[model samples]
Target: MALAADFRHRYVTPEASLYAGEPTRCEELAELLRHILQMVDRNTPFRHGAYREIYEALHGFLHAGIGGSAKDGLVWGVKDFWAVWESICLVHVVNQNPGDILTCDMEHLPVLLSAPERRRAWLKQRALLFARNGIRRRPDLVLAGGDDIKVVDFKYYAYMRQQRRTAEADEIDKIEKDYLSMEAYGLLLQNHFLRNADARANRLSLEFWLPGAKAARQPSRQQPPWDPPLSVVHLPAEDLLRGYVALYPHLRLMR
Candidate 1:
């Protein structure tokens, strides 16, 4: 079966042109995405019907007009795509190290609150606590080996190039706010794992994956004061594996 079927309507053509000069690299990316889909289909608990739902949604998103009535599907599809893509990348990276154990879609990590009442309240709030505006904040992938644990969060923007060149003030503001939200999510993960006795002494790292324009990382004055001190790492889609290895040297892939 094909890894990713071509959409009947192309929402973004420049995505092809973006790789105009690098056929090999483009092919590699396509294969990786396909492998990811196949692995998820074969190994994950999601059934064939679930895979169809994803494909149908992606198809609809691609065919819909920009800013059209199908905006919700487009948004959902983009988010789902990145979530799967990040999982695949992390799995590939960790598998390179035969000794490391990689876990995808990990859940039930304790929320950072200490008091039982506060934890209960946060749990009751649920979606409100985990979401900023309409965007949900959650860790996408985790890797553990020996005494170290790494939690990764991925944020994918398909039109980041266009956003960089032409996004208005309000749009820019929204992006900054999203970064702050991501920072909060990272801190939450770090604190949550640290509070666990088993993981307390383990090395923990939280990272944000933003595969966009170089300028996307420029410090913004509107950033939240409480944002974590860690900086967002700009990782081009093509170099995801390399960038990840650099950030977590302990999880290096064996050549």
Candidate 2:
């Protein structure tokens, strides 16, 4: 029931170090609030068995050659959004299946950021300010289709079970938020790689997967079943922006 110790990658670059640290202030506070909310919602499954399955698998893959692996059991809690993101990316991005992967080297861009200090400054200026921000949480795969560049983040979470039967009254307020995040990323892609006047046009598209196991139990208030098919959500530029705006304030506090 204790929070997990930080498991950030050890091979942190100066940019990465600066990037991660910058979000701590406001994001930490927002997280404290979220934690309190979760405590009040005891019926909620903040951490579940599914999360542990994905985390351990991913930890194994990351440190397989380094002589380490994730511990057994749920290695992450429900609030640990990154764990879910990584899970989706591993299947869709790294594996490069149904989704095509873009292989451009993104690290080289910072070299042209005038001075190292300028790169840091640019990141701070553009960092997201909202809940579930992805400025530092870069996805695993970049997909290019026609004129669009799609970024994928994997996720897993239990929405309100009662909402399954009663629309709006019981279920979580599912909206077009995911699309908004993708839009923000699209804008970022355009600004960073395409719209810099000197850069090329890279119209980016972002997408994600929320894979859920089919429920073996009967549908009921206590043991609601997962949706029959996998719950896959895709967001375009406009939708992504909305999600960003909605979550931006809490997100900025992190930075």
Candidate 3:
């Protein structure tokens, strides 16, 4: 029995500064996300009921036995360890990666399992090139999925909307102006993760799942008119990237 039980350092070092810096650095991205979330929050307000139910159910389960589940109070902000681990596990099962899976929270994977370790290895192998300059915007999920690396943004919305200019209001071309609202997130992920990393396959996948709807639009029944398909306009990845780059310049003035 090699169990040493002598206590040494007691208090946990509070890292308030790191969290405090998150807001100012990611103001622009947060603002854009807030804009989109506002639409879901206000117009389709009733849809949030389902999200609340899920959050409550998960919270109850975690509090009942699982201890490490951090509670933030806000329905949307609740960080359940099980949810995160399940997501990682699902990806691993589908991808069939040999590397172990790991997370920041140690309690989430206390068994020292091979899968968790493989997951962590995959994450570390990514050529993560993040710019820590003017304003910092860290990607929500940064990890390597075997051969190719993935930078993902976990978006939780009640409903997705398509905004058009009203008859009396200004003529705003939201769809044309932006290809994909998520493109900015893609660019941000690239700037932070892929750029200056190892010589690996760099691909960014923006994972968004709404409370009432799937993250992206479903595939169409008929064939498209264009090569890549016009329905892709629905995805609008380029639009999102453009928006992010355009907003990047303004980040310096945000403070």
Candidate 4:
């Protein structure tokens, strides 16, 4: 069976957009479903929790059409879209280097606070940090190769529709929160991974894949205290592969 057909057979229900009469919406949903399945198939050692979360979230959105409470549904649908998008990008990079190891939701990292007591306090406060942020902050993908490690976090936001001021504000808030979380992750990587003499030094990269943005923004670099540089790449979702290459040019040599 074709990929789309196979996905529909496995996951799509009569309530899903695939069965909705709208041609354009149906086609778009079908393509997304297919892309997600392809990502799952290609990316071994995938996080079952993330996959399941996205799958269920999409299902809920499809079941609740525009006629219903679609506002919440759209929020969840886009959330899952980003999850699937990140999976697809990570899978492509992993395929390029067969020998490299990729891990998802990597939470444990060395804490290099000056005092041993401080290190323990920081470790114990991880839960508090997450609670304060209102989101679980962790690297979406971790690539380890030849003593070098690359930490990547993915952010997706649709371009702001001028009419929806509230939604735009929410997205802006999310973007800021993600940036702060990424900064923390960068610090963890530097103190935990790069502190070792044998480890290869590399910076953490945040790929903000905004498909709806009006224009592409230039990549910016930031250096946080006790952390290596953090590079932020703003690109459209269509250019994820290009963004990946821009962030990690070394991956091209592996191909």
Pick the TM-score winner: 4
The digit string of per-residue lDDT tens for model 2 on 27-145 reads: 55445434544444455556578765555544443323222243221122333444533432332332234334443212312122134464354344334311134335343345555
Question: What lDDT does each candidate get?
Answer: 0.45, 0.38, 0.36, 0.47
- TM-score per candidate: 0.36, 0.30, 0.31, 0.40
lDDT of 3: 0.36
Please, what are the lDDT tens digits per residue for candidate 1 over residues 69-150?
Answer: 4311112222235543454355444446523433333222211212346334434434433455576654455446666665
Candidate 4 collision pairs: none
Question: What are the per-residue Cα lDDT tens digits for candidate 3 across 97-180?
Answer: 333221222222223223445545434533233333553333334445665444333333233343323448565454423324
Task: Rank candidates by lDDT, best first.
Answer: 4, 1, 2, 3
Supply candidate 3's per-residue lDDT for 130.
Answer: 38
Error of 3 at 43 (Å): 48
lDDT tens digits, residues 3-55, model 4? 76876788766566653366666777767765775566568575588777666
Q: Each prediction's Cα RMSD?
A: 13.7, 19.2, 20.0, 14.3
Once fitted onto the true fold, the runs of candidate 3 whose alpha carbons sit more than 4 angstroms away are: 1-66, 69-127, 134-149, 155-158, 161-185, 192-203, 210-255
Error of 4 at 108 (Å): 20
Best by lDDT: 4
